[model samples]
Structures are given as C-alpha cells and as structure tokens.
Target: MSQFDAQILVAAFELSYNDWTLGLRKSNMQVDVLLQNEVLRRGSSILEQTASSLSILPAENADIEGSNLSLRYDDGALLILGEMSYFDLEGLFVDTDSFYLTTGYRFGQWLPHITYARLNSTDDDIRRAPRIETIKNNLPAGSADQIAVATVQSLAPILWNQESTSYAIGVNYFFSPQVVGKLEAKMVTDRNGTISQFQNANTSGASAPVIPDDNRILIYGLSVDVVF
Candidate 1:
C-alpha cells in the first residue's frame, strides 16, 4: 500500500496481488513485478545523524521498482526466491540498485533459510561518501553545503555498495487450515564496507571518507498469520 501526498495534496493507491504461477513436476514457480515507495519516516536515524555536535539531516522519499521470482517444491518443503530492486531517490544523495537471493528448506516442522543481498550505487561518484561536487551542484548555497557536510560527518546509515549474508532457523505450527504461527531466529553478517560520510577536512576543500565497521546481529521474532 502507498500514498503520494506532497504539500497537502492527497492521492491514495493500493497494490493488488497479481502473479503468474506455473506448476512443474514437483515444484511451482511464480513471478511478479512491484512498484512501491520506501517511505522514510521523519526523524529516522538513517536520515538524521546522532553525533552530539552535528546537525540533523532530513529523510527523503524513495521510489522502488522491483520484481520477484520464486519457486516452491513439494508443498513448501523447499523454496528459492530472487529479487532485483532499484531505488530512485528524491532530494537524496544517489540512486541505488539491489539484488537479493534466498533459499529455504523445511524438514518436518523445522525450516531453515539463508539469504544474500547486495546494494550498489548508481551514481559512481558516491562510492564511499556523497560527492562534494554533487552536493555543491544540487544544493547551491553555503548554508546548504554546510548542513550536508555536517550530516555526513554525523555518520548516518547510508547504503553504499555492500554485501551481506543472513541465516535463520524457524518452525511453523498450524492452528487451522487458515491460521499459523512462526518463530525464527536470524543472524546477519555485514562485512567491512565503505559508506558515504563527511569529514571536517572536506569542509576545507580536502578529501575525507569514512569506512564502516564490520558487524553482526542476531534477531528473534515470532509471527502469526491468518487468512479469510
């Protein structure tokens, strides 16, 4: 679901589920296209820097266009999914393209899944950090440049080119034909990568870029599904 409201002018829209499914000897394949928006909520940390001495940055809206192709084998015993998504930015630094691949296997009620994803910038100038030349051109004032620089200096989470892998183990319990509950624990590994950042030296017309740290996170979640 999505709504486009700019300057109090309101327009609403919803997406319908549409896909083409083909049945094979032992598997089913499906494909679909999606047009959506990744609406960045105001005050999101991705847009705002948390460094005590830096200024706050505003979040920008992104238009996402993507498609998904998936296959399921033996009534959900095994599954594979792949997707390619492109993000168009509004008043942000650069556009990005992403690719994702996922596979899952189910043994009785236990399901294990793994996913790989990569994000790359379309704007070559924004390899590690937003280009100062781009900033100066997009925002032509001294004040705007200062804010942009400060925003980068604050180390906001900007998705530069990076690759990550995640693994999850879960089980599904069916309460009825139309209802189910699922529990899963997932761990994600983010390798060392360079994201766009601002440096005080850059303010003085020098080059300064920041390299992000490698990290990992584990998440546990439970979810319920119901169908009418």
Candidate 2:
C-alpha cells in the first residue's frame, strides 16, 4: 500500500514503517551503517456529541455502560530521513487511489511528512427498539382467582445500516541519529458514505436508513519505545 520515488540527486533516501520495524533505504550517498530506533506516541479520545445518540438507551458517564463503542481506528507512523531523502524542492507525489503521500524538510530542524488512510465503519449494532405490553383479564365471579396475561403489543423496529468515513493525517519526527516522536489525527464525516441504510417507525414494509448526527471528535495519544 506504499511507493517510494527516491530522488537521491539531492540527498540520501531512508524510510521506515510501523515504528522503524519495516525499513527501506535507497541513497546515492554511502552510509557507514543504517541506524534504527523505536518511535512512540501517546494520545486521547475526544468524544463527539452525536456519539451518545447512537445508542438506544441514555449513554452514561461510561460508568453505567461499557466503553463508548467506536468502530473506527487511528494510529501514528514514523520515518527516519537523512537515512533516506528524496530530491530537492521538486517534490514527489504518490497516490494510493484512496490517499496521498507527502513530505517536507523545513526550518532546518523539522522534517514533516503527511499521508492519508481510508476508513469505513459499517458494523454498528443499531437494533430496533423493542415493544412490550401488559395485559389484565377479569376473573369469573368471586369464586375464581384473578387472571393476568403479558404479551408483546408489537416488536421493536430495527435501525438501518450506518456508514462512516475515517479520514486521517499523520506526522513523524526524523531527527538525526534518533527518531523523536509521532502524532496522528482522524475525523469521521457526518453521514458520509457511498451507500447507507435507513429505518422507519411505520413497522410496515422495509424502512429507510436512519440518519446520524453531526459532531467533531479528536483522538490522540503518546507512547515510548523502550529498548534494553
């Protein structure tokens, strides 16, 4: 899911994936040895307002219910340049049909790289709300005991399919001799999907897909790589 167009005409070429585990180096300059290190990051989850309405019952402070269910994913990626640098300011463009690849060297101290990853969450459990009813029947005269019957007035309806898009961006630090840290940010578009489902209260034939709310959420984290 990646491509490398190394422009060694200007500098060395070095890249890493999954925190320096998967490394690829192609440089015009000769290197004494390929340096490698672990890169880590830490982040937090920003709950959106609409995330609560997704459930049938009222969402408590995560105390009454389990963790606010999330069907999306976001992570950080790091790369060590100088070990691998493309051409000059000519720039490079690589496309993955879903996302794009970009990098930059600025301020003499920071080398920023950015990329996009597609996300799809269609596995949400939005079952229809159930219906319940209580029935009471009169007994025959005083000699008989009271009779009561409980039955289902009607079954609850089901919520139609829900889809989402998880567009993301990531930046990593590739300082000389060491990779400092990494950061990533992702946003899910409101009701953003190619095809979606719907539900109606009519309980008639098939219902249309239900609509989701609008909310902005942010999730970030930090971590460290311990090498003994």
Which candidate has the top score in TM-score? 1
Worst 10 residues of 2 by lDDT: 37-46
lDDT for residue 24 in candidate 2, whole number 0-100:
38
Model 2 clashes, total count: 21
lDDT (CA) per prediction: 0.44, 0.28
lDDT over C-alpha atoms for residue 178 of model 2: 51
| TM-score of candidate 1 to 2 decimals | 0.47
Candidate 1 weakest ten by summed lDDT: 26-35
Regions of candidate 2 where Cα sits further than 4 Å from its true position:
1-109, 121-162, 175-179, 190-213, 226-228
| Candidate 2 accuracy as TM-score | 0.26
TM-score on alpha carbons, each prediction: 0.47, 0.26
lDDT of 2 at 76: 37
Model 1 per-residue lDDT tens digits across residues 30-100 = 21212132222221232234321111212223222333333333345666666555544332334556666
